[model samples]
Target: MIARIAMLFVAAAPLALAACATPAGEYPSLAQREIERVGMVMTPPQTTPAPPPNPTEPVLSQARELVESVRTAHAAFLASESAVRSRVAAARGATAGSDAWALAEVALAGLSTQRSRAMVALADLDRLFIAASTSGESTETIGEARSEAADMVAAEDAVLSELSAQLAS
Candidate 1:
């Protein structure tokens, strides 16, 4: 019984020493440390500026030139308007396709040709007005010039209509 007890004690001593020899894992610290406070900076937003106004002198000069051209054409048309009116008056009672009617038609054609000169200038004005409008430029002066030329053309059209009516009757 004594020898058996001695052998059990030796076996227990080795198992206890093996348990103590095994290593343990590392642990985290719970102590508090100093902290730093950071500040946020901001910048202003950027914006685009409006465009500058364009110069008016060049446009005004071009408008004046175009208006002058219309006036010249109008003057030429007016010079022939009286002659055409007389021809139409003489053919007022003539039969269709007669010599008088043919002469009146020729006179009317001449007047129309003269009026076409003014129309050409008016067309140019229209082009300028459109270009200015599309390109974001000012169109007031161009519009005024176009209006004046249009009025002259309208007057010519009225005269033509009157003469045509007289000839038709």
Candidate 2:
């Protein structure tokens, strides 16, 4: 039993040594391969080139369109207000309990509601302009639009106030 164990150890020793040894070839040693792999991992990766800047023409055009839309809405509101005023004026001499006076009252109420809606719409447009300006859009166009919108909104407020006073009287 002792002789058999010695023979087995002698046979396995050469196999174990061979496993630890690198075979003779063109391939690099284990240490060299590890160093190369580590170098590759430690090195920074190459970056891609950046894209060109965007054109401003489209942004400016869109802002102009929005401004035009606000102008159109403002004009429509003014026309409606004028028509309502004419109706109210025509009914001015009617008795309080008469059908004409009641119709005029209804028209006044509707005008007040419409005025509120127009104010809200103008506010929403203001918010949109502010957002566009803050988000790096073309500031020149946006500034002009904002200025115009502010003026329109102020005029609308004045007209609405005057209408309210008229309705009271």
TM-score of model 1 vs. true structure: 0.65
Those runs of model 1 whose alpha carbons end farther than 4 Å from true positions after fitting are 1-56
| Full-model lDDT, candidate 2 | 0.70
* Best-fitting candidate, scored by TM-score: 1
Residue 147 lDDT (model 1) = 100
- Whole-model lDDT values for every prediction: 0.89, 0.70
Spell out the clash pairs found in candidate 2: none
Q: How close is each model in CA RMSD to the real structure?
A: 19.7, 11.2
Displacement of the residue 47 alpha carbon in candidate 1, Å: 26
Model 1, range 1-169, lDDT digits (tens) per residue? 9999999999899899988784444545455433322343445688888896665677778889999999999999999999999999999999989999999999999999988999999998998899889988899989999999999999999999999999999
| Model 1 alpha-carbon miss at residue 30, Å | 66
